[model samples]
Target: MNKTKNYDLTIIIPMYNEYENMERLEKKLTGYINKARMKTCVLLVNDGSTDGSLGRIKDICERNTDFFYISYDSNRGLSTALNAGIDNTESRYLGYMDADMQTDAEDFDLLLQHIGSNQIVTGIRARRKDTGFKRMQSKIANSFRRRMTGDTATDTGCPLKVMWTEYARRIQFFDGMHRFLPALFSLEGANFKEVPVRHYPRTAGKSKYHLWNRLRKPFADCIAFRWMKNRYIRYEINEKEL
Candidate 1:
Protein backbone atom coordinates (compact mmCIF):
# COMPACT_ATOMS: atom_id res chain seq x y z
CA MET A 1 0.00 0.00 0.00
CA ASN A 2 1.07 3.61 -0.60
CA LYS A 3 2.15 4.86 2.79
CA THR A 4 1.07 8.37 1.76
CA LYS A 5 -2.41 7.37 0.69
CA ASN A 6 -5.26 8.92 2.62
CA TYR A 7 -7.66 6.68 4.51
CA ASP A 8 -11.00 7.38 6.15
CA LEU A 9 -10.63 4.50 8.60
CA THR A 10 -7.73 2.31 9.70
CA ILE A 11 -8.53 -0.97 11.44
CA ILE A 12 -5.85 -1.95 13.94
CA ILE A 13 -5.38 -5.68 14.58
CA PRO A 14 -2.97 -6.59 17.36
CA MET A 15 -1.23 -9.91 16.74
CA TYR A 16 0.66 -11.91 19.35
CA ASN A 17 1.64 -15.41 18.21
CA GLU A 18 -1.38 -15.68 15.98
CA TYR A 19 0.29 -17.28 12.98
CA GLU A 20 -2.43 -19.90 12.69
CA ASN A 21 -5.10 -17.25 12.29
CA MET A 22 -3.31 -15.10 9.71
CA GLU A 23 -4.64 -16.86 6.64
CA ARG A 24 -8.28 -16.46 7.66
CA LEU A 25 -7.62 -12.92 8.87
CA GLU A 26 -6.20 -11.97 5.51
CA LYS A 27 -9.22 -13.31 3.68
CA LYS A 28 -11.76 -11.61 5.95
CA LEU A 29 -10.01 -8.25 6.15
CA THR A 30 -9.39 -8.17 2.41
CA GLY A 31 -13.06 -8.81 1.76
CA TYR A 32 -14.04 -6.12 4.22
CA ILE A 33 -11.76 -3.55 2.57
CA ASN A 34 -13.21 -4.27 -0.84
CA LYS A 35 -16.79 -3.54 0.27
CA ALA A 36 -16.15 -1.17 3.16
CA ARG A 37 -18.41 1.85 3.21
CA MET A 38 -15.47 4.17 3.80
CA LYS A 39 -11.94 4.24 2.49
CA THR A 40 -10.40 1.66 4.82
CA CYS A 41 -7.01 0.12 5.52
CA VAL A 42 -5.67 -2.45 7.98
CA LEU A 43 -2.79 -1.87 10.40
CA LEU A 44 -1.38 -5.10 11.77
CA VAL A 45 0.70 -4.64 14.94
CA ASN A 46 3.01 -7.57 15.56
CA ASP A 47 3.86 -7.69 19.28
CA GLY A 48 7.02 -9.75 19.20
CA SER A 49 5.52 -13.05 18.29
CA THR A 50 8.30 -15.62 18.72
CA ASP A 51 6.49 -17.85 16.27
CA GLY A 52 6.56 -17.35 12.52
CA SER A 53 3.63 -14.93 12.82
CA LEU A 54 5.80 -12.03 11.75
CA GLY A 55 6.65 -13.80 8.50
CA ARG A 56 2.96 -14.42 7.85
CA ILE A 57 2.09 -10.79 8.66
CA LYS A 58 4.77 -9.57 6.28
CA ASP A 59 3.54 -11.85 3.52
CA ILE A 60 -0.08 -10.79 4.05
CA CYS A 61 0.77 -7.09 3.91
CA GLU A 62 2.95 -7.61 0.88
CA ARG A 63 0.15 -9.33 -0.99
CA ASN A 64 -2.60 -6.90 -0.06
CA THR A 65 -2.29 -3.28 -1.06
CA ASP A 66 -4.54 -2.12 1.79
CA PHE A 67 -2.55 -3.86 4.50
CA PHE A 68 0.27 -2.34 6.57
CA TYR A 69 2.20 -3.39 9.67
CA ILE A 70 4.73 -2.48 12.38
CA SER A 71 6.64 -4.88 14.56
CA TYR A 72 8.85 -4.79 17.64
CA ASP A 73 11.53 -7.22 18.83
CA SER A 74 10.01 -8.06 22.21
CA ASN A 75 6.53 -8.82 23.46
CA ARG A 76 4.99 -5.65 24.92
CA GLY A 77 1.49 -6.93 25.72
CA LEU A 78 -1.82 -6.02 24.09
CA SER A 79 -2.12 -2.46 25.42
CA THR A 80 1.28 -1.55 24.05
CA ALA A 81 0.52 -3.04 20.66
CA LEU A 82 -2.78 -1.14 20.48
CA ASN A 83 -1.15 2.08 21.64
CA ALA A 84 1.48 1.70 18.94
CA GLY A 85 -1.24 1.34 16.35
CA ILE A 86 -3.09 4.39 17.66
CA ASP A 87 0.05 6.51 17.69
CA ASN A 88 1.17 5.40 14.24
CA THR A 89 -1.95 5.61 12.09
CA GLU A 90 -2.82 8.69 10.02
CA SER A 91 -6.45 7.83 9.35
CA ARG A 92 -9.31 10.03 10.51
CA TYR A 93 -10.99 7.11 12.28
CA LEU A 94 -9.47 4.08 14.05
CA GLY A 95 -10.96 0.65 14.52
CA TYR A 96 -9.65 -2.27 16.63
CA MET A 97 -10.18 -6.01 16.48
CA ASP A 98 -8.18 -8.99 17.64
CA ALA A 99 -6.41 -11.23 15.10
CA ASP A 100 -8.23 -14.24 16.60
CA MET A 101 -11.10 -13.87 14.12
CA GLN A 102 -13.65 -14.07 16.91
CA THR A 103 -14.95 -10.66 15.89
CA ASP A 104 -15.94 -9.93 12.32
CA ALA A 105 -14.13 -7.12 10.51
CA GLU A 106 -17.25 -6.40 8.48
CA ASP A 107 -18.96 -5.17 11.64
CA PHE A 108 -16.77 -2.09 11.52
CA ASP A 109 -19.41 -0.73 9.19
CA LEU A 110 -22.02 -0.91 11.95
CA LEU A 111 -19.84 1.04 14.35
CA LEU A 112 -18.96 3.58 11.62
CA GLN A 113 -22.52 4.82 11.40
CA HIS A 114 -22.37 6.36 14.87
CA ILE A 115 -18.91 7.92 14.51
CA GLY A 116 -20.56 11.20 13.41
CA SER A 117 -21.95 11.78 16.92
CA ASN A 118 -19.99 9.59 19.31
CA GLN A 119 -16.31 9.93 19.97
CA ILE A 120 -16.19 6.15 20.50
CA VAL A 121 -18.58 3.55 19.17
CA THR A 122 -17.99 0.07 20.61
CA GLY A 123 -19.58 -3.31 20.14
CA ILE A 124 -21.14 -5.42 22.85
CA ARG A 125 -20.85 -9.10 22.01
CA ALA A 126 -24.44 -10.24 21.98
CA ARG A 127 -23.89 -14.00 22.05
CA ARG A 128 -20.41 -14.79 23.28
CA LYS A 129 -19.01 -18.24 22.46
CA ASP A 130 -16.67 -18.58 25.37
CA THR A 131 -17.01 -21.21 28.07
CA GLY A 132 -19.33 -20.71 31.02
CA PHE A 133 -16.56 -19.88 33.45
CA LYS A 134 -14.98 -17.36 31.10
CA ARG A 135 -18.29 -15.64 30.52
CA MET A 136 -18.94 -15.43 34.25
CA GLN A 137 -15.54 -13.96 34.87
CA SER A 138 -16.12 -11.30 32.24
CA LYS A 139 -19.49 -10.44 33.69
CA ILE A 140 -18.01 -9.95 37.15
CA ALA A 141 -15.09 -7.91 35.85
CA ASN A 142 -17.39 -5.67 33.86
CA SER A 143 -19.62 -5.09 36.86
CA PHE A 144 -16.67 -4.14 39.03
CA ARG A 145 -15.26 -1.84 36.37
CA ARG A 146 -18.55 -0.04 35.90
CA ARG A 147 -18.82 0.61 39.61
CA MET A 148 -15.33 2.05 39.71
CA THR A 149 -15.24 4.04 36.45
CA GLY A 150 -18.97 4.81 36.05
CA ASP A 151 -18.69 4.23 32.32
CA THR A 152 -21.95 2.67 31.09
CA ALA A 153 -20.30 0.58 28.39
CA THR A 154 -21.75 -2.93 28.53
CA ASP A 155 -18.70 -4.64 27.06
CA THR A 156 -15.52 -2.61 26.93
CA GLY A 157 -13.60 -5.81 26.30
CA CYS A 158 -15.22 -6.44 22.95
CA PRO A 159 -12.45 -6.22 20.36
CA LEU A 160 -14.59 -4.62 17.68
CA LYS A 161 -14.66 -0.86 18.10
CA VAL A 162 -14.35 2.42 16.17
CA MET A 163 -13.34 5.85 17.41
CA TRP A 164 -11.99 9.11 16.13
CA THR A 165 -8.23 8.93 15.91
CA GLU A 166 -7.86 12.17 17.84
CA TYR A 167 -9.67 10.80 20.90
CA ALA A 168 -7.86 7.47 20.58
CA ARG A 169 -4.50 9.22 20.65
CA ARG A 170 -5.40 11.00 23.88
CA ILE A 171 -6.11 7.79 25.81
CA GLN A 172 -3.75 7.17 28.73
CA PHE A 173 -2.02 3.95 27.77
CA PHE A 174 -1.39 1.43 30.50
CA ASP A 175 -1.05 -2.34 30.98
CA GLY A 176 -4.81 -2.84 30.90
CA MET A 177 -5.84 0.14 28.81
CA HIS A 178 -7.40 -2.15 26.23
CA ARG A 179 -10.05 -3.16 28.76
CA PHE A 180 -10.74 0.40 29.83
CA LEU A 181 -10.98 2.30 26.54
CA PRO A 182 -14.50 3.57 27.17
CA ALA A 183 -13.54 4.83 30.63
CA LEU A 184 -10.32 6.36 29.32
CA PHE A 185 -12.25 8.18 26.60
CA SER A 186 -14.77 9.32 29.18
CA LEU A 187 -11.94 10.88 31.16
CA GLU A 188 -11.32 13.08 28.12
CA GLY A 189 -15.04 13.98 28.15
CA ALA A 190 -15.67 11.94 25.02
CA ASN A 191 -19.10 10.47 24.37
CA PHE A 192 -19.52 6.72 23.72
CA LYS A 193 -22.18 4.44 22.31
CA GLU A 194 -22.29 0.64 22.45
CA VAL A 195 -23.99 -1.52 19.83
CA PRO A 196 -24.31 -5.26 19.84
CA VAL A 197 -22.10 -7.21 17.41
CA ARG A 198 -21.43 -10.81 16.49
CA HIS A 199 -18.84 -12.95 18.27
CA TYR A 200 -17.32 -16.36 17.44
CA PRO A 201 -15.21 -19.04 19.08
CA ARG A 202 -11.50 -19.11 18.40
CA THR A 203 -10.84 -21.92 15.94
CA ALA A 204 -7.08 -21.39 15.82
CA GLY A 205 -4.30 -20.03 18.02
CA LYS A 206 -4.48 -20.66 21.75
CA SER A 207 -6.34 -17.99 23.72
CA LYS A 208 -3.86 -15.52 25.17
CA TYR A 209 -6.04 -14.60 28.13
CA HIS A 210 -5.96 -16.64 31.31
CA LEU A 211 -7.76 -16.28 34.63
CA TRP A 212 -5.00 -14.12 36.03
CA ASN A 213 -4.93 -11.53 33.25
CA ARG A 214 -8.65 -11.55 32.64
CA LEU A 215 -9.88 -11.41 36.24
CA ARG A 216 -7.18 -10.69 38.80
CA LYS A 217 -5.21 -8.18 36.75
CA PRO A 218 -8.30 -6.25 35.81
CA PHE A 219 -9.21 -6.02 39.51
CA ALA A 220 -5.85 -4.45 40.24
CA ASP A 221 -6.06 -2.19 37.16
CA CYS A 222 -9.53 -0.97 38.18
CA ILE A 223 -8.16 0.41 41.42
CA ALA A 224 -5.34 2.03 39.51
CA PHE A 225 -7.86 3.55 37.11
CA ARG A 226 -9.78 5.00 40.04
CA TRP A 227 -6.63 6.53 41.49
CA MET A 228 -5.74 8.04 38.14
CA LYS A 229 -9.30 9.21 37.60
CA ASN A 230 -9.24 11.27 40.78
CA ARG A 231 -6.09 13.16 39.75
CA TYR A 232 -6.65 13.16 36.00
CA ILE A 233 -6.22 16.53 34.30
CA ARG A 234 -8.42 18.01 31.65
CA TYR A 235 -8.45 21.45 29.95
CA GLU A 236 -9.89 23.24 26.96
CA ILE A 237 -8.46 26.04 24.83
CA ASN A 238 -10.89 28.90 24.81
CA GLU A 239 -9.05 30.48 21.95
CA LYS A 240 -5.90 30.03 19.93
CA GLU A 241 -3.93 32.05 17.42
CA LEU A 242 -2.41 30.36 14.45
Candidate 2:
Protein backbone atom coordinates (compact mmCIF):
# COMPACT_ATOMS: atom_id res chain seq x y z
CA MET A 1 0.00 0.00 0.00
CA ASN A 2 1.22 3.51 -0.78
CA LYS A 3 1.18 5.26 2.53
CA THR A 4 0.26 8.94 2.30
CA LYS A 5 1.90 9.92 5.55
CA ASN A 6 3.08 13.42 4.58
CA TYR A 7 4.91 15.29 1.87
CA ASP A 8 8.31 13.93 0.94
CA LEU A 9 9.56 16.98 -0.92
CA THR A 10 9.24 20.73 -0.58
CA ILE A 11 9.79 22.80 -3.75
CA ILE A 12 10.61 26.43 -3.06
CA ILE A 13 9.99 29.09 -5.73
CA PRO A 14 11.31 32.58 -5.09
CA MET A 15 9.24 35.28 -6.74
CA TYR A 16 9.81 39.02 -7.02
CA ASN A 17 7.13 41.02 -8.88
CA GLU A 18 6.24 38.13 -11.15
CA TYR A 19 2.52 38.82 -11.40
CA GLU A 20 2.30 38.07 -15.12
CA ASN A 21 3.66 34.54 -14.78
CA MET A 22 2.11 33.52 -11.45
CA GLU A 23 -0.84 31.47 -12.66
CA ARG A 24 1.08 29.59 -15.32
CA LEU A 25 3.86 28.94 -12.85
CA GLU A 26 1.38 27.35 -10.44
CA LYS A 27 -0.26 25.25 -13.13
CA LYS A 28 2.95 23.93 -14.65
CA LEU A 29 4.56 23.23 -11.29
CA THR A 30 1.53 21.45 -9.87
CA GLY A 31 1.09 19.39 -13.02
CA TYR A 32 4.71 18.24 -13.09
CA ILE A 33 4.79 17.40 -9.40
CA ASN A 34 1.61 15.37 -9.71
CA LYS A 35 2.96 13.43 -12.64
CA ALA A 36 6.24 12.72 -10.82
CA ARG A 37 4.34 10.30 -8.50
CA MET A 38 5.84 11.73 -5.32
CA LYS A 39 4.35 13.42 -2.29
CA THR A 40 5.59 16.87 -3.28
CA CYS A 41 4.44 20.37 -2.25
CA VAL A 42 5.30 23.93 -3.22
CA LEU A 43 6.58 26.75 -1.03
CA LEU A 44 6.22 30.10 -2.76
CA VAL A 45 8.50 32.75 -1.27
CA ASN A 46 7.37 36.20 -2.21
CA ASP A 47 10.42 38.43 -2.00
CA GLY A 48 8.58 41.64 -1.33
CA SER A 49 6.85 41.79 -4.70
CA THR A 50 5.21 45.14 -5.32
CA ASP A 51 2.65 43.61 -7.65
CA GLY A 52 -0.34 41.37 -6.84
CA SER A 53 1.85 38.26 -6.77
CA LEU A 54 1.41 37.69 -3.06
CA GLY A 55 -2.40 37.73 -3.24
CA ARG A 56 -2.35 35.26 -6.11
CA ILE A 57 0.06 33.04 -4.20
CA LYS A 58 -2.23 33.09 -1.15
CA ASP A 59 -5.26 32.30 -3.26
CA ILE A 60 -3.54 29.37 -4.94
CA CYS A 61 -2.21 28.00 -1.67
CA GLU A 62 -5.64 28.24 -0.08
CA ARG A 63 -7.37 26.53 -2.99
CA ASN A 64 -4.77 23.87 -3.62
CA THR A 65 -4.13 21.34 -0.92
CA ASP A 66 -0.38 20.82 -1.55
CA PHE A 67 0.59 24.43 -2.17
CA PHE A 68 1.75 26.96 0.42
CA TYR A 69 3.27 30.44 0.51
CA ILE A 70 5.14 32.92 2.77
CA SER A 71 6.19 36.47 2.09
CA TYR A 72 8.47 39.24 3.31
CA ASP A 73 7.36 42.89 3.44
CA SER A 74 10.60 44.33 2.04
CA ASN A 75 12.87 43.25 -0.78
CA ARG A 76 15.68 40.92 0.11
CA GLY A 77 18.07 39.23 -2.30
CA LEU A 78 17.72 35.69 -3.62
CA SER A 79 19.88 34.28 -0.85
CA THR A 80 17.52 35.52 1.86
CA ALA A 81 14.45 34.33 -0.02
CA LEU A 82 15.97 30.89 -0.43
CA ASN A 83 17.11 30.84 3.20
CA ALA A 84 13.58 31.68 4.27
CA GLY A 85 12.26 28.76 2.27
CA ILE A 86 14.91 26.45 3.68
CA ASP A 87 14.10 27.51 7.25
CA ASN A 88 10.35 27.07 6.71
CA THR A 89 10.32 23.70 4.99
CA GLU A 90 9.31 20.54 6.85
CA SER A 91 10.06 17.78 4.38
CA ARG A 92 12.56 15.06 3.71
CA TYR A 93 14.00 16.74 0.61
CA LEU A 94 14.14 20.34 -0.62
CA GLY A 95 14.06 21.65 -4.20
CA TYR A 96 14.56 25.11 -5.65
CA MET A 97 13.50 26.79 -8.89
CA ASP A 98 13.21 30.34 -10.06
CA ALA A 99 9.88 32.06 -10.84
CA ASP A 100 10.98 32.72 -14.42
CA MET A 101 10.28 29.14 -15.53
CA GLN A 102 13.48 28.91 -17.52
CA THR A 103 14.19 25.38 -16.38
CA ASP A 104 11.94 22.32 -16.60
CA ALA A 105 10.16 21.36 -13.39
CA GLU A 106 10.18 17.66 -14.23
CA ASP A 107 13.95 17.72 -13.83
CA PHE A 108 13.35 17.79 -10.08
CA ASP A 109 12.54 14.10 -10.23
CA LEU A 110 15.85 13.47 -11.99
CA LEU A 111 17.72 15.43 -9.34
CA LEU A 112 15.70 13.80 -6.54
CA GLN A 113 16.85 10.36 -7.53
CA HIS A 114 20.45 11.33 -6.77
CA ILE A 115 19.74 13.08 -3.46
CA GLY A 116 20.17 9.97 -1.27
CA SER A 117 23.84 9.42 -2.00
CA ASN A 118 24.60 13.11 -2.51
CA GLN A 119 23.55 15.94 -0.25
CA ILE A 120 23.05 18.21 -3.27
CA VAL A 121 22.37 17.60 -6.98
CA THR A 122 21.81 20.40 -9.47
CA GLY A 123 20.65 20.63 -13.07
CA ILE A 124 22.99 21.80 -15.80
CA ARG A 125 21.39 23.67 -18.65
CA ALA A 126 22.24 21.59 -21.71
CA ARG A 127 21.10 24.19 -24.18
CA ARG A 128 20.52 27.53 -22.54
CA LYS A 129 17.87 29.71 -24.17
CA ASP A 130 19.26 32.98 -22.86
CA THR A 131 20.70 35.68 -25.10
CA GLY A 132 24.26 35.76 -26.35
CA PHE A 133 25.22 38.58 -24.04
CA LYS A 134 23.77 36.89 -20.99
CA ARG A 135 25.50 33.65 -21.87
CA MET A 136 28.83 35.40 -22.27
CA GLN A 137 28.42 37.15 -18.96
CA SER A 138 27.58 33.86 -17.23
CA LYS A 139 30.58 32.17 -18.80
CA ILE A 140 32.93 34.86 -17.55
CA ALA A 141 31.43 34.86 -14.07
CA ASN A 142 31.50 31.07 -13.81
CA SER A 143 35.11 30.90 -15.00
CA PHE A 144 36.16 33.43 -12.38
CA ARG A 145 34.21 31.63 -9.67
CA ARG A 146 35.81 28.30 -10.54
CA ARG A 147 39.30 29.79 -10.30
CA MET A 148 38.58 31.63 -7.04
CA THR A 149 36.52 29.01 -5.17
CA GLY A 150 37.84 25.84 -6.90
CA ASP A 151 34.37 24.18 -6.71
CA THR A 152 34.80 23.03 -10.38
CA ALA A 153 31.15 22.38 -11.17
CA THR A 154 29.83 23.66 -14.47
CA ASP A 155 26.53 25.53 -14.79
CA THR A 156 26.07 26.41 -11.13
CA GLY A 157 23.66 29.15 -12.23
CA CYS A 158 21.19 26.69 -13.73
CA PRO A 159 18.58 27.70 -11.11
CA LEU A 160 17.08 24.23 -10.59
CA LYS A 161 18.42 22.11 -7.79
CA VAL A 162 17.61 19.52 -5.11
CA MET A 163 19.37 19.20 -1.79
CA TRP A 164 18.93 17.19 1.37
CA THR A 165 17.14 19.33 3.93
CA GLU A 166 19.89 18.91 6.50
CA TYR A 167 22.60 20.09 4.12
CA ALA A 168 20.43 22.98 3.03
CA ARG A 169 20.05 24.14 6.60
CA ARG A 170 23.75 23.85 7.31
CA ILE A 171 24.64 26.33 4.57
CA GLN A 172 25.97 29.67 5.86
CA PHE A 173 24.56 32.21 3.41
CA PHE A 174 25.11 35.91 2.86
CA ASP A 175 24.27 38.40 0.12
CA GLY A 176 24.77 37.03 -3.43
CA MET A 177 25.06 33.56 -1.92
CA HIS A 178 22.86 31.84 -4.49
CA ARG A 179 25.64 31.86 -7.10
CA PHE A 180 28.03 29.92 -4.92
CA LEU A 181 25.87 27.00 -3.79
CA PRO A 182 28.19 24.24 -4.94
CA ALA A 183 31.20 25.99 -3.42
CA LEU A 184 29.44 26.47 -0.12
CA PHE A 185 28.32 22.85 -0.05
CA SER A 186 31.91 21.81 -0.63
CA LEU A 187 32.90 23.92 2.34
CA GLU A 188 30.48 21.89 4.46
CA GLY A 189 32.11 18.69 3.12
CA ALA A 190 28.85 17.45 1.63
CA ASN A 191 28.77 15.35 -1.52
CA PHE A 192 27.15 17.00 -4.54
CA LYS A 193 26.56 16.17 -8.21
CA GLU A 194 25.47 17.86 -11.41
CA VAL A 195 23.15 16.41 -14.05
CA PRO A 196 22.14 17.80 -17.38
CA VAL A 197 18.61 19.26 -17.58
CA ARG A 198 16.51 21.09 -20.12
CA HIS A 199 16.32 24.87 -20.33
CA TYR A 200 13.68 27.16 -21.88
CA PRO A 201 13.25 30.76 -22.85
CA ARG A 202 11.53 33.19 -20.53
CA THR A 203 7.98 33.62 -21.83
CA ALA A 204 6.79 36.34 -19.49
CA GLY A 205 8.06 38.75 -16.83
CA LYS A 206 11.44 40.42 -17.13
CA SER A 207 14.58 39.12 -15.45
CA LYS A 208 15.50 40.94 -12.25
CA TYR A 209 19.27 40.66 -12.87
CA HIS A 210 21.35 42.74 -15.17
CA LEU A 211 24.92 42.36 -16.41
CA TRP A 212 26.37 44.27 -13.49
CA ASN A 213 24.20 42.69 -10.84
CA ARG A 214 24.64 39.14 -12.03
CA LEU A 215 28.31 39.04 -13.00
CA ARG A 216 29.96 41.87 -11.08
CA LYS A 217 28.26 41.08 -7.80
CA PRO A 218 29.45 37.50 -8.00
CA PHE A 219 32.94 38.72 -8.87
CA ALA A 220 32.99 40.80 -5.68
CA ASP A 221 31.58 37.90 -3.68
CA CYS A 222 34.27 35.61 -5.05
CA ILE A 223 36.89 37.84 -3.41
CA ALA A 224 34.97 37.62 -0.17
CA PHE A 225 34.68 33.82 -0.47
CA ARG A 226 38.45 33.57 -0.97
CA TRP A 227 39.01 35.31 2.33
CA MET A 228 36.42 33.17 4.10
CA LYS A 229 37.91 30.02 2.60
CA ASN A 230 41.42 30.67 3.92
CA ARG A 231 40.20 31.63 7.38
CA TYR A 232 37.65 28.80 7.49
CA ILE A 233 38.14 26.34 10.30
CA ARG A 234 37.55 22.69 9.52
CA TYR A 235 38.34 19.90 11.98
CA GLU A 236 37.18 16.38 12.67
CA ILE A 237 36.01 15.02 16.03
CA ASN A 238 36.83 11.35 15.98
CA GLU A 239 34.86 10.21 19.00
CA LYS A 240 32.57 11.67 21.65
CA GLU A 241 33.01 10.76 25.27
CA LEU A 242 30.28 11.90 27.62
lDDT of 2 by residue, 121-166 (tens): 9999998999999999999999999999999789989999998888
Q: Each candidate's lDDT (Cα)?
A: 0.92, 0.88
Q: Please tell me which predicted candidate would have the highest lDDT against the true structure.
A: 1
TM-score of each: 0.97, 0.95
Cα deviation at 47, candidate 1, in Å, is 0.3
Tell me how far the alpha carbon of residue 181 in candidate 2 is from the true structure, in angstroms, after superposition: 0.7
Model 1, 120-236: lDDT tens digits are 999999889999999999999999999988889889889999999998988888898899999999998899999999999999999998888899999999999999999998899
- Those runs of model 1 whose alpha carbons end farther than 4 Å from true positions after fitting are 1-5, 239-242
